[model samples]
Target: MTTLTRPLLVTLVDDYDVVLTGLAHMFDDYRDRILVSEIDANAVLHDAIDIVLYDSFAQPESDHEEIAELVANPQARHVVVYTWNFQPELVQAALDEGVHGYLSKTLPAKELVEALEAVAAGEVVVIEPKRRAASAAGLDWPGRREGITDRESEILALITQGKSNAEVATLTYLSPNTVKSYIRSVYRKIGAESRTQAVLWGVGHGFTPDHHRIDHWLGGP
Candidate 1:
């Protein structure tokens, strides 16, 4: 593991306790590169922190206000969104909101730490341009039900893509409780009793990826 002369003090902001715990474990191996000081969904900092890492598993746009709030906090000198949803417009919006970095969740742990270190040193970072471009092209879920809200549709799309509630919370910038509520609503609307059933229903109703774009999005040769 690579070590930094001064490890960045990082606080993770996510809606799920399990997600926070998992991230803490991932960073624990690189003690010399980064220190996981605090984890909370509200971006509260008990002590001075060098970096605030916001994990967006699926909902980047929805979390803009929270990101802006964290950026305005004096304790957060650097704010980065570590996300799987790489819509270019959303990334640009985050930058506009004063985010220091927007990085892909696909990045290896070491690379993520390095990105945080760079952000702490007063640099703006964005990883995986091609993926962001492909994402910007969009991942649409057709055949939506009549009453589902846009946010519900977005969460349903991610659910069909096989994301857990915790993952969904991270992606959508929603609290896990919020994610669960959305899921329940989606289930009632679609008549799904379980995740597997929802996924099956989504597939039957056109919750599918554009294969051509997916190939490019995954960096396939």
Candidate 2:
């Protein structure tokens, strides 16, 4: 049999032991190719883990910084977060942190498995649009997202076309960090909280076109 090398490693943290144990078990079946570790909240893993599924442990955690740090790490290219609930703001925060995948505690095992593998392969996974957000609270772009200068708008348009940041940096002749910063600023200004949100808001506001049709975002500024 052809064996997969390097099991996908995961770390779990939660206040409830039972919950942590159950999670460890659920993912235990992949032991041969998926190593699972349950660790204390304060642990900063020395070896690279395939993903981390965590919740409150010893203290109230700061979400964005942690997620961003993981994404920023060369070893954490495939960071995935699993949470008990999907809060739009929190979920968006993870996206801004460059998280690769996220699934609510209620996601089906089959789907979760697919998501884990996808993220491990370096693809980002997005959750379903929040019910309320679709109804009304979705997002609003009051004016041009504040931090984005004119040059940044040009870059944002490129990303909307599915271009990678590196590709954008090459095209714009700007540094990768500059591109990332622009995206973050756009997110902040539009109350976007996420890349998807930034895209939706930009398209909604006329920075990017719908591409579905020729209708103006809000039919005009």
Candidate 3:
């Protein structure tokens, strides 16, 4: 591991406040190594940031344009994608966009800090897939308190946006069968009998994203 003179200045980027806040707290134990400078939803990047960790919750995994925009930003020294999806195409696409790291959400806080330290030292990091029974702790998402896993909530969010199962699978890099399985789980947990009812429930809850990160950052309409 690279020894830093000081803690690396990091920023968390995502549309959901809950998700950002949870990620920020995950590094609380490793404050000496990695300092979360800010959690941004729509704010402009004014200060210099060593790394910007883009959390890919409820977002299309293949949105390379947004990643490219982030890479082009001068204030962001390095960009890293923090996500659960590890499809080879998605990884290659993100790397092609000049991302410094493509990390998994399944990584624990300590390992996450280590990965960031490696990125700070100018090494491109790509976390390999592991057979994890559960994702890392100290993370939160919309409807998590209501027993909805992050993946399930993401599926519901896409469904709320009127995405068909096939579209959801495409965007999330999951199989169509996996998408259906997640939908079934979501319906069971939310007491919904059909797609319409599930969409209604998702609408009532916080399934929709507040704004797109790049648009909000660029102050576009």
Candidate 4:
């Protein structure tokens, strides 16, 4: 007798219903490799899902907290971000938030399935390594080489934008607690004791809006 394994169950999440529907169709031919079990902005998994793919379209930075929440979901074993934006900072931020895979939207349907399968098998996959490398090379913040991560720099830049913690939470989709934690880490790295001082340090160290284009990419006001 031979044992037959079940297909990997997947959930597709996106703000747009059209995107969810399209993704479901894209995976139709890969029924053996994976099953599109659920498709909705708020995907409620009735059963355990092997992978939860979050489509960011063009706004990857704004979805970080959502990705973190999905990764922490009880029903989600693996979480992947499917996006057209391959900005290194966004990719690094997603990975730091526990996203299992970062795949380009331009990937062929078959390749996307394979990447998801790899993620389901406990592998971290990221397409567009060249772009990621280029983005990383451009991260020359004053404290970046001193151990501050890409995520920290992003939060610092947000602070410089005069965004309150709650506003930051809304923009970054992170909880207040998580935003505060990141703030603490940023403060420690830059040796700032207050938000005002941190903002000053960020301004003085080149963590400015001109350098951090997250707002532009995310279409923020």
Candidate 5:
């Protein structure tokens, strides 16, 4: 009988030789079922690379941007950020820039592997709650868009605008309580917990802050 391989290609991009070595060992320990590649940021794009787990500190901004654009291509399945001292907007920026998902170095390696496998299967491994909050934060809605109502869409628009609940209420002339309700629905739809994550979720689903869009919110533009 032939052995069917696990349909995932994993890449490790880190500047620290020690970290890379340790990651290599961990991947190797996983029965080699996962194909692991140790790569520098300069490496050319390869269709076989399904997920890229890269270090934020190792590469320069230019190189990182190049890598991000490359990962944005259809060929690269996902790119997970692994580093400390990440700014609030880093993950959302990555999603906007076209990467798949974000993970911190502090998370367990096994969960990271699972996330990679999930992304490889063409399913987004989400990290936020957006649907619930979206409805609560009523801002203003666009003409036509996703299945959500115009009012719900407006909340999303305000969310993408980086407006807090209080801000949304003030801008839309809605009670803060109503704004909070819309935000909760938004969170439920986007699977985002925090406002930043909801913004990212909005971006991830192509739901611009145009008073419209859907999906479990990850990040936004």
Candidate 6:
């Protein structure tokens, strides 16, 4: 008789419902290998999870307090960061926080599943995807439909959250000049001429962080 392995139980974390919903759909075809147990936003887990994949949408990166909190969760066997930024210092800091994985946002769904399996097996995985002009298919963010790239949308989200340019650079591991470039692009895309205007536009367009808990896929008890 042949033995069958059970799918790995995983939870997706992000501040936006759209972002987490898109991420959950990416694993639809790989249900045999990975089971999405929940889609949450800074909420505590009620059930045991093999991996907690924290999506760094608008939130601060590696050094953020939330990452440390997740690392200390007893229900989460392993904590991983799913982000677009992969500077060496950021990666090292995340590892130092006890994260099991630091994966790039550009990874294809299939590759992402493989990476999660590796993390579950106790391997420290850090994958920096090749430079790409766009995010992977099946992924969504706040301003994606408005012709904003994922990176630009992230900057807008941070700005909406009252992050200054210097703070944004620190959180994203981007240089000040690069951050300004992205801000300019976001301004053009959203028809905002000033930071105040951009922030107002962001506020009405789902850029503000959603603090309420969400169980998008698996209903909470």
Instruction: Give the alpha-carbon lDDT of every model.
Output: 0.67, 0.54, 0.82, 0.66, 0.55, 0.84
lDDT of 3 by residue, 90-122 (tens): 899899889999999889888999898899899
RMSD of each: 12.9, 18.0, 4.4, 13.4, 16.4, 2.8
lDDT (Cα, tens digit) per residue for candidate 2, span 1-221: 12235666666544344345455555544555556665544445566667766542211223355556556666443667765335566567777777777765455555566677777776788755344221111111223245554445555666665667888766555589988987787667668777787667655555543212211111111
Question: Model 5: how far is 157 from its true place, Å?
Answer: 40
lDDT of 4 by residue, 88-193 (tens): 6778888888888998766767888778878877789998543322222111333556577645655676788788898877666668998899999988988889
Give a tens-digit lDDT track for model 6, residues 8-108. Answer: 88888888877887888888888778878565545777888888999988788745688888889899998999988778888898899999999988899
Expressed as tens digits, the lDDT of each residue in 1-221 for candidate 1 is 23346767777675533344455666656776676754544535556678888865333355577788888888788889876666667888999999999987566667777788878777899985444232211122243335665457668768888888988887766699999999999899888899999899876765544222110111111
Q: Which candidate's TM-score is highest? A: 6
Q: Give the TM-score of candidate 5.
A: 0.48
- Clash totals for all candidate models: 7, 0, 0, 0, 56, 0
Write down the TM-score for model 3. Answer: 0.89
Candidate 2 off by > 4 Å: 1-5, 56-65, 68-75, 128-221
How good is model 6 by TM-score? 0.91
What would the C-alpha RMSD of candidate 4 be, to one decimal place? 13.4
Instruction: Decide which is better by TM-score, 3 or 5.
Output: 3
Candidate 6 lDDT (Cα, whole model)?
Answer: 0.84
TM per prediction: 0.59, 0.48, 0.89, 0.55, 0.48, 0.91
**Which of candidates 2 and 4 is the stronger one according to lDDT?**
4
Better of 2 and 4 by TM-score: 4
